[model samples]
Target: MAGNDQAACADGPDFGPLAIEARGLVKRFDGVTAVDGVDLTVPRGAVYGILGPNGAGKTTTLRMLLGIIDPDRGYRRILGADRPHDVAHAIGYLPEERGLYPAMKAVDAIAFVGALRGLPLKEGRRRGRELLEQHGLGYAADRQIRQLSKGMAQQVQILGTLVHKPRLVIFDEPFSGLDALNQGKLERMMHGLAQDGTTVIFSTHVIAHAERLCDEVAIIAGGKVPFAGPVDVARDRIPAQVRLETRAQDGPWRAALPADARHEGSFWFFSLPDTGIEPLLRALIEGEAGILSLSIERAGLHDAFVAIAGEAAARALEQEKPEELRR
Candidate 1:
């Protein structure tokens, strides 16, 4: 079996090369397809993101890849293993639904999680304390999970995920509930992991987080990924845009605007074509159009999502609850 060969080839659950590779993954629930055929690849030492809206099958896909649930049809290779369970010891998973014993102290909870991942009790406790101190939560280490603030609890849970020093860390909506300050801390932690040659993959409904953190991203919508690749490639889906607010709405300057120019409120917005804006500026000047303000905006991940996934998905994303709530 491929799994047997892989197990024998490595001393442990080594990544070999890629941290994750899945192909033609499909899963259904009660006859309704939850995940369509999908392929995902994540390289070692990279920060990858699975981005989608609520109920978009991101969770289903991740579950299948992790071997938490069997796929209706597909195959996955995680950390050189034919199945995730074969390499479970190399992975640290933080599920979307976070739970900790309410009565357990923060440090003890972390050590318990580490123990579940095969770490020794004493080592787990030692690492837990160090992690808490490094993350500015040393004072809360003795506090009960229920006594800590939401942000403190979240940090404690994340520290537990890393207590075993996994080669690949997977987080399902790790930012689901946190304030801006805590979110920043999580971002820094992810970057640190990648710098240390640990692969990080996380699912998120929030575009800003992925845009800021991901080296590569997959945009899942309608139970499928319409786009997946480098973050820069996605941003390039749309060209730079120029927004101009002018006193004169009509005149030769009107002709200067691109046919695709969109009028929104007092400003006209149009893609900044490769031909450049010099000609447009001259035309506006010749037409005596009083330009109130002009600005150029680069395409963002949200814009790419709208272009690839459609306005409906983009609207849903904007309307989705703030990444703050119990999963």
Candidate 2:
């Protein structure tokens, strides 16, 4: 039955101009909807992030896309194949649950994982050793997984995921167990992969990582996507903010300030007026408002997430718990 499905996916219509496409994807478990009408479009060679709080259906959505679980309604294509596992050879996936044989040596575990993905044992071992050495894990290559620290073991699994040199890589909550140094290393590795033209997708509640690493992102909340597009586009949904420090708090120019503007000490904060800053600046100068300092800054991914997904979802991100518990 699986073989027949693979054949059908192989012969299915090509999904043009996108690395991943999904329309109205829906999934449910035990009569409870976990994902609802989620859609995504990921371009080739881009680093895309699925950004959401815990239990917001990120894992379920990823599973549906990867064919690990089927959606109740809707369709998806990965690497132009109608079924994701049909092109399994071209993809690498790192699940949230981390596991490796404790008795196996680090390099052997990596090689073993590659072998499951159809890489020959001999060549996989060679690549595994090379990967370990390149990533500064050469000294631990011969050490058993049980001998390594949790972070080191996780690093071995990450290398194993890449040993086969896949075209599309998906990582679910890949940063959970790593220390700050390992997290920095992983960020660099992701950048290197994107530079080599690989498509990278990851799910995370960490807005900082998505802001720094993702070219595009989808913001999911309450099992629905509120926004999905280039990172810049999401941030641009809110206008730039203005911070003005003036020596004079009371002047004719005060009327030019936004009605909702607030001040702390000498600084005033408000959104950039739709009329633009030029008019405001002219008014300030003419009224001798004594502008001391001025800065206009666009909203960041965190602020954008709050605005798009709501405060409830933002709180969920801050107080992250196991997804199962939330569900």
Candidate 3:
């Protein structure tokens, strides 16, 4: 449904224009702040991720941006509309709490969702069937919701979200119940959506998924955003790691190593020198250190998250289950 509408930019993906913008957004529940001055700027046609641990206000922040609930403070704009609901027809939302009528056929269910977004019932049904066929669910089209597996049912709902061909799509914890195969399918779907100039946003505590799919991310902890920017920028906060194995350890090359360098077995590890690797390379070669293997490893999103949001937040991300499961 995505690539049919708009062709991707010629040179590269154009994430210049802003699709959603929020400033100093704050929300409270019973006087306890749920979102604290969260700010975000999501670019058009970009796949953006909101990363945080459970109870870190990611959902609350998304709710505020969608105008599902009024923020206690701050303002937001969606698709250039002052009120998000004014342009609701152009937006698709797959909330964390998934639900559909158990009695309805999968196609009928998808069509019904499209109808709510102002799509013609007849056209919706036609598109629903086509979508089902495209997503390898054609055999299940006539089947009732209750007849499908949990994953299949969720896929139906996701197809419903896209039936209207929304310009902007938001998914909250869409991967929670999905198997690895389904998760990969969803990732491809998000990529297709972005390539078609659709602004895609999703929230997740799983750093791996975000790292793989998101062009940019906002890392939240304790209801506050510690860092929000391009994934590369976040990863750049920590220095690259250097791993070196040499034939001779006691040489001039050893002196070139950083003060913080540590030896373990036959390898020496340390952060990449601020002066850069060229000097170190020259020293090693000139000193005849007999380099066996040398590697520079950049920090991953998980490491960056720990550095930015602290170890406690990272632990919460690893330990916390989905809200529904916890409940």
Candidate 4:
């Protein structure tokens, strides 16, 4: 329904050259629809993101794409393959619920997971050791996962995902339990993967992470995608804002301001006018309004998310995180 041709196809579905494509993907659990007619396209080598809340069907959608679970209706393809298992060797996935053998050594755990992905045990062990050393976990290789810190354990899981050298990497709520430092590390890892021509796709409720790491994103709320596209396109969906402050917040210069301008705490804020700010600046100068400051705040991913999904949903996601995490 959302820009998808739902009609039956005679020649089968054409997913074009996309790394990932979903045509009217739908899922239901106990009569309740988890994913409702969603379609997505992730270009090759691009960092794509699914932005949504905890229960917004993000996990369900990802699971369906991975063939971990089948959709009730519609179809999905990955790396031009009709099923995930067909290209299973070409993909790496990190699930939201972290899992590892607590009694297993860090390196062994990684090697074991890699072996499952078709990598030889010896090769997996070699690559796993190198990855651990590169990620500053060299000394912990022989240590049991239970003996490692939460962050270190998480890093081990991430290394296992990469040991196979997959062409596409998918992360489901990768930032869920990490601290800011670990989150930063994960961001760098995603960048590194994309730089190596890996198509990275991650789902998270945190919009800031998407803004920092993703080239394209789809915003889902209440099991429906209200917006999806390039990061710049999402930002452009809302108008920019202008904030002005002056000693005198009145008189003829005030008349030049847009009707939507609102006065709050010795400042005037409003949507930036399409004509230009030059005319407004000139008017203020001529009227001797003593302009203290003027600035334009370009719409950002967070603003676009709020505008599209509403403040209630935004607040629900933000909660009361630390200032640094929010930034």
TM-score per prediction, in order, is: 0.84, 0.91, 0.94, 0.89
In candidate 2, how many Å is residue 299 off? 1.4
Assess candidate 3 and give its lDDT.
Answer: 0.89
Task: Please identify model 2 stretches exceeding 4 Å from their true place.
Answer: 1-16, 321-327
Model 4 lDDT per residue over 142-237, tens place = 999999998889989988887888878899988877887788888887887777667889998888889999999999988888888899999988
Task: Give the runs in model 1 whose Cα sits over 4 Å from its true position.
Answer: 1-17, 244-257, 262-268, 275-294, 323-327
Give the best candidate by TM-score: 3
Residues 65-144 of candidate 2 have per-residue lDDT tens digits of: 99999999999999988888788877778999999999999999998988877878888888788888888888999999
Identify the runs in model 4 with alpha carbons over 4 angstroms from their true place: 1-17, 247-249, 286-288, 320-327
Winner by lDDT between candidate 3 and candidate 2 = 3
| TM-score head-to-head 1 vs 4, winner | 4
Instruction: State candidate 3's TM-score.
Output: 0.94
Ranking by TM-score: 3, 2, 4, 1
Q: Write the per-residue lDDT of candidate 3 for residues 84-182, one digit (tens) a residue.
A: 888787788899999999999999999999898888899889989888888789999999999999999999999998888888889999998998789
- Give the lDDT of residue 173 in candidate 3: 96
lDDT for model 2 comes to: 0.87
